[model samples]
Target: MSNRWCAVVRCFVVGPIGNKFAPLGDPGRQSYEDSLQVFEEVIQAACQQVGIDPVRADQIAVAGEITEQVFRHLFEDDVVIADVSGGNPNVMYELGLRHATGKLTIQIGEFGQLPFDVNTVRTIQFSRSPRGLIDARNQLERALQAGLLDGQDVLTATRIFQESGEGKAEIDLPLPEPSIEVDGSDDEPGFLDNMIEIENQLALMTDNADGVASSIEVIGAVTESVGAELERAAQSGASNSARLALISKYASEISEPVEMLEKSSADFASNMTSINDGVLSVLGVIQNGDPSELPEGWDGFLDQLIGMAESSREGMEGLNTFGTAAEGLGSLSRQLRGPGRKINNSVGNMRKAIAKIDAWERAARSIKHKAANNPVG
Candidate 1:
C-alpha cells in the first residue's frame, strides 16, 4: 500500500482568547475546555480512520489577534477542522471566507451553537458525551477525505475563478424565451396558439438549463488554469513551503462556495428533467387536438419553470460568492508562493492583478443580477 502523508489539520476555535472565558464562569470555562479536549480526541479518531498519525499532524489555535496568521497557516495545511461551538463572529467570518476559497474544510459544532446561515451546509454535531465526540470525529474525517480527493474537480474550478479575478457569478436567473408564430394553414382555433406557447415554454427551459451548464463549464476552465499557475509557482521555487501553506489556506477558504454551487447545479438539472417530462406530456395532449386533456394545474407548470429559473439564479449567486473568495485566495496564494525576499518587489504587480480580478467580478455580478431580476412568464 502507498504511504499516506500526514494531513495538516487546522482547528479554528471561535471564542475569546486565553484567560477571558467570562461568558462561561470558571466552572463552565473548565467544562468548555474539557469539551474542547474532547473535540481534539474526536479529531484524533478521524485521523486514525484515514490512516494518518494524529501525533504527526499540526494543530494550531485560532485566537483573535492571529486571524491573518490563521489564514496564512490555513493555506499551508492539508485540511481544516473548524469548531463553531461558541457564538463567535470572527470564527463565522473566517469560516465564510474559507468556504469562498473552495478548500477542504469540515465544520463541527456543538449541538446548539451552529449559526442559522450555515445550517444548510453539512456539519458534524456532537454532544458532550465521549461517544458523541468519537462519532463526530469519524464522520468529519470521512467528509474531509471525500472532499479532498473526490472533490478535486470542484476545488480546481473555484481556484480558476480566483486566478481569473472573476468574483462569484450569480446562478439564479430566468432564461430568455423564444417567440413562435402560428401558421394560418392550421384548421383549429387556439391550436396554433397552444403550439406556439408550448414551444416558447420549452425554449425557455432549455435556455435556462444551458446557461447553468455554461457557467459550470467556465468554472471548470478557470480551475484548470489556476492549477497550471500553481505548477509554475512550484517549479520556479519562488515560494517556500510556508508561503505554499498560505496559498493552500486561501484555496480552502474559497472551496466551500464552489462545492455548494456544484450541488445546486445537480439539483437544478434533476428538477429540470422532471419539468421537461411534464411539458412534453402537455405538448402531446395539445398536438392530439385534446386541449381539455391539459391538466387543471397547467398554470402551475409556469410556476415550476419560474422556480427553476430562480434556482438557477441562486446557483449563480453562489458561484459569484465563490469567485470573490477565489480572487482573494488566488492573489494571496500567489504572493505566498512567490520568493520571500521578492514579496515586496511584487506588491505593486499583485495589487494590479487583484484590481483586474475585481473588475471581472463586478461585470459578472452585474450580468447575473440583471438575469436574476428579469420577469418570468
Candidate 2:
C-alpha cells in the first residue's frame, strides 16, 4: 500500500517462451519471439503499474545455483505471476511450487490454451492483439493490486489442501524440542514438566489471540472511518485523484494493524498446534492405559487439561469476535474493491485459525472426558 513496501516488493514471472499453438480459431501458432513480446507488453507492464519489479526465469542473470535461486524466488518472493498459456512442463512445475507456498500468485493464459487442471484457477486471458493485450494488462494490474494488498486473497494449492478437510492442516513452523527427554530414566520428567510447557505455550497463544482481536478492533474502527470519508468525498463530487488519495491514506493507516493480525494469527495457530500435539500425545497415553497407570501428577494433569480447554475456548471466542469484525470491514468497503478484497482475504485466514483452535479445544476436552470416565481399577 505504501511506496516503501512497493519499493521492495519482489516478483517473479514464469511462463513458456518456446513456440506453441495459439487458440483454436485465432492463429495456428505463436512464435517464441511473440511470447516475449506479450510478456513485455502485457505482464511486465502490469507488474510495473503495481510497483512490482518482475524478473522472468529466463531473464535471471545470476550465476550461483541458478536452480536454487529460481526455487528460492518462487518460494519466498512476495508475488509470482505464472503464465500457463502453453502448459509448458517447466512453467507448470514452477507454478506448482509457488502454489504450495500459498503466497500471492496471479495466473494468466490464452483463452483456449489453458490446461484442463489449471483452467479451474482464475486466470487472466490475453491474445496478441493490441486491444487484447490492453485488457489483459488492466486485469493483471487489478489482480496484482488486490493480491499485493492482501495475499490471503489468492487460493493457492496450499490453501486448497488446508481447507479440503481431508486432514488437519498444519502450517510449517520450527517446533521446539520435546519437553521430556527420551532417555528412559525413572527420574525423567513426566506430566508436570510437559504440562508446564503446555501451559507456557497456551499463555503465548492466548496473548497472540488477544493481540489479534485488539488489532482487528482497531482495523474495524479505522475502516469505518475511512469508508465514511470516501463516501463523503464522493457525495461532494471529489476528483478521482482525491478519492484515490483517501484510499491510499486508508491503506497506510490500516497496514500496520493488518500486518499485526496476520502475524499474531499465524503465531496463535502455530502455538495452538504445538500444544495440541502435546495434549493429543498425552490423551493417547491416557486412553490406552488404565487410569491407575497415569503417573504421579494424574489429578493435576486432568486439572491442567481442563484449564487449557477453558483458555482455548476463550481464545476462540476472541478470534470469532475478530473474524466477525473483519467480515464486517469487508462488507463495509465492498464498494471500494481493493480494500474489500484485502479484508475478505484476511477473514479467510482468521477462519483457518479459528478452526485450528477449535480442534485443539476439542482434543483437550476429550482428554478430560476420557480421564473422567476411565476410572482407575
Best by the TM-score measure: 2
Whole-model lDDT values for every prediction: 0.48, 0.66
Model 1 weakest lDDT span, ten residues long = 55-64
**Residue range 252-327, candidate 2, lDDT tens digits:** 7887787777777677767766666676555455544555655666456556555544454444444444555555
Q: What is the C-alpha RMSD of each candidate to the true structure, in Å?
A: 18.5, 15.6
Question: What digit string (tens of lDDT, one per residue) describes model 1 on residues 1-377?
Answer: 12264323333333323233547657556655654574457765676566554321122211123444465434434556676666457667666666655666677787987778667667788887778877887787777677657753344445776667552434322222322223334554343455446446545545644544454465456556666766777777766774466456434543443344444444444444444433443333322322243435433433444444334333443344434444444345454332222222222222232222222223333343443444334
Residue pairs clashing in model 2 are: none
Clashes of each: 40, 0
State the local distance difference test value for candidate 2.
0.66
